[model samples]
Target: MSAPDERETLATSLYAHVLALRAAAPDAPLPPGGLPLPRGARPPRDGAPGPRAREAWPAVTTLVRSALADADPVRAALALERELSAAGIRDRHVYAAVAALPPPEEARDRARALARALTRTGTTVTAVAAGLGLLVPLGEPEDVPYLRALGLLEGLGDRAARALAPLDRKAAAVAWLVRERSDALRPLVDALVRGDEQAARALLTGLSTTPRDLGRRQARYIAEAVGLTALLRDGPGLLVPAFGLLARMSEGPEAEIRAYDEALTLYETVADRARELPPLLGHRARLVTLVQELDSGDARLLPWPPGRRRAVLTALLTAVGEPENLSDPAASADWRRAEWVHRTARHLAAVTTAVEAGGRRAGAAGVPPTSRLRIEVAVGDLGEPTGVETRLLVDGRPLVPSVFGSGVGEPPETVLLNGALRAGPQPTEVRLAEAICTEGCCGALYVTVRRDGPHVVWDGWRRPGAPPGLPQAPAYRFDADAYDREVSRAERDLGWAWPARRTAWLIAEGLRERPGILARWGLRRGWISTDFHRPDVTVITFLGPPLRPDGTPDAEAATRQFLRHLPDDGRPPRERAAEALRRLAEEDPRRHPEPGE
Candidate 1:
């Protein structure tokens, strides 16, 4: 019902919220006073008086006292009030309790006197009181005047003072100081010079649209103080702009060379002061041009001690001349005559240093160097005897090995492989092998060798019976020993029947003499051998008259039906024949259903 009572209720709610948070996170630090004061009033003061003695008590003192009491509640009721405040629970009854306190006429004057004393003395009490007034027990806008009069705004760090200023007045205060008190910018300038990045950023942002002269002066002061010639070269913004200015200066004639030289010296100094900045590439190029204009033997044109001169010369040559011939023939003689060799060596040394520096920087930044190789293989038509070749790619490069072979027989067959390779800490070999063959036959074949693991695998040929044009047998696995044994058996069987063809007596006397059988089929006429298996499907063209049983063609029906069904690609003839039988059964009327009956 009353203001004080309402404040108490809010305080109790805040207290309860804090308690809940603390309970949830046991390790969390307890809130100040272990509770929050009421939203619009301060906590009760100790040893001063109860509600019966207060009159016009300062809102800040009241908040501080109440918070202190809640932080150290004497009674369970007080503790409960704190918990309620922390939890944000409000009660009009708390306001009613405040209304019952002594009239303001009696207490207000005394509270002000005590607050003023504390503020002037700059005691912890003043800090607490100021914190309470600014942060809690938010009172009327007029209350801010009363607090400021007590000197609460004096003797605080810029950041802290800014933070403590009334939210609505902070921007206006900053604007007033920047306009009326130009010297106020000194702190900001000093901060920048000291490399206090946060302060410098704040100052720069605050005066973003200010005069360029002021901004440039501020930046220059900082650059000079911090020896940031590079920043000066870079110009205007965050980086030092001196190098950029020097580069601009260097563009004129010989008379301007002195100014350019001075700028370079400053740049070198800046570089020494800040080890991070590299020598300006543009500046280096200009130096090369100057050296080229001068006589080669001019001592002043040279850099310094022999080594240093060599380094400067090398950098200049690198900037202006063609690259060194690393692959030159008459190597020693050519290199001895090469004017740029010394410079090139110096440049290379610098490069090595730069690389080392980069590595160190990366290490410091906690970035790990990457060292991994990736291999990709595309295999096609795996199962068929006329299988597709595999292309192996390593790190996106096509590797062309001088010697590649498949260990299938006495003399290994040359195989084409594709891929790339990179030298590693140890030699890494990537072996590409097929794992399964589902093309010509229903069998698995695997090829293996010891090498680095293949990274990417792809199929170029689709398996038989799969969607047409889709990759089928990407890889196959084969047992080399078993494959060799099978090959040996096949060879032996074919070899044993080889000479049987030459024995005409054995063929005519021992076996039935059938001239037409041999001639009609062309088995004898053609170089046909049992060792080679024909594809299941064949298209035989007859150029002559069709043969009869007696080796003669009947003129009436000379062209007879000569359809020979063979297996499809990758399928055995027997399997094709079985499939054909199924097709025949389905075609028969007995096995078919009448259409639309």
Candidate 2:
């Protein structure tokens, strides 16, 4: 049968099912199978519409109301369908129009019928989105399957989530979507545990068995759902999963983890629970992670008072046991070589003597026992065939691994000279080297740079999200004055400049001197920068939107203008750059080459 005929049959069947169920038991929850979908071919993809469309299309409400005013039910439905089709998911007012139908039972019933029909048999994602929005206040439990099935479609998860929000069984509906798209996990768990006592317990209980690897962001949501206050109150009642949650919490961004109120109490609770529970291998692995985080001195355990810190450390060490004594041999071996285990053995004194005067051990001369010694970035060939690379040199030895190099799309000047050593008032992390594939795919070496009195401290050493067993750099302290001089000297010494480097340098200098030039092209000066993508050419890059949307020239236009005017030759960089900038300033993009032209 034709698509329209199939949709008509499904709509008719759905109406019959709802009426029969209502007649049989007026107050009973509707069956899951009440609304059957049309079996027609799937609709074409239009990306999910965002709230921007609602902001842009201010006339959406009037159009929707006009559609709904047709007196004949068939024509009203047809008119409403046209509005949804025209506006699609873009016009959110379409949904608001149906929801706001004047509340005579007849008009509301008509709105409900229209929503059900669109949800059941609509061909396009927009129709589905419109249906979902309309149903936000009016959807019955029976509409869930339609929501779930269409929500499983690529672009409909958020729309489905909103529609499900008003239903009694929202948790089940939301959970069904989350299983298919883990991105929606936060809202699901948040909705479940928000202020409801029984629901919080159920959420925690359900999360207890969930797979440990939900990626960092999702795991944090789970922790936030089972918040510190909730955990402190209810944590003792639970066992293993609480430990799992704590372990995940330890791996989160340190600032957020530290913000967990009554942290000392929470740590003590976890330490006590570790001793009480049977030490399964999973628990052991999690324990090792917690212990590792505690020992790292990267701000996790630093905030606690010496007495409290000592007590927690003592409890954890006693509970975790020596790696050699572990029952599982493979697990034992893994823990034996682990960084924290080694650090604990060496600094067992600092932890134990926390309450004692001068108990902190001594380090190499001029360095605190707790702080890693200072290091410096030294430029060297180190085997890359193209541009120069950088490595962290500690005591004249290459400390960072050779595998990390200046990856494509970033220039060495940006990576090393300016970016790495810049210290802010707050502790800041700078990626010293990225994986050959780039920072996103494989991890990068990030050192936290902060000022400590007369010296600048680079202490929190991490290879975040990197695979296990890459070399971890120790923290370093350097004289702030000397560090500044070295960076300045490095900046002035331009012996490393090749053709690509020279071009990038010129563009950077030109932009830095006259920041207003980018504004004429509708670009933010802060967003603009330069990269040496190849040895032969320099590419201008943007950290954010390259151009404003008001019919102005974009990054590509800037790049083309610069490339056409600037050429590699014996001419000085400053001279050539000035010439290029002068020419660029003379042109008017608005009149010559308009937006989208």
Best by lDDT: 2
Off by over 4 Å in 1: 1-129, 132-154, 158-368, 371-597
Q: Tens digits of per-residue lDDT for model 1 on 115-188? A: 23322222222232333232222333443433322221222222222222444243213322222224545555
State residue 65's C-alpha deviation in candidate 2, in Å: 11
Error of 1 at 496 (Å): 77
TM-score of each predicted structure versus truth: 0.16, 0.40
Give the clash count for each candidate. Answer: 78, 0
RMSD of 1: 33.7
Candidate 2 Cα deviation (angstroms), residue 497: 34
lDDT of 2 by residue, 236-268 (tens): 655666666666555412223443444566678
Which residue pairs in candidate 2 collide? Answer: none
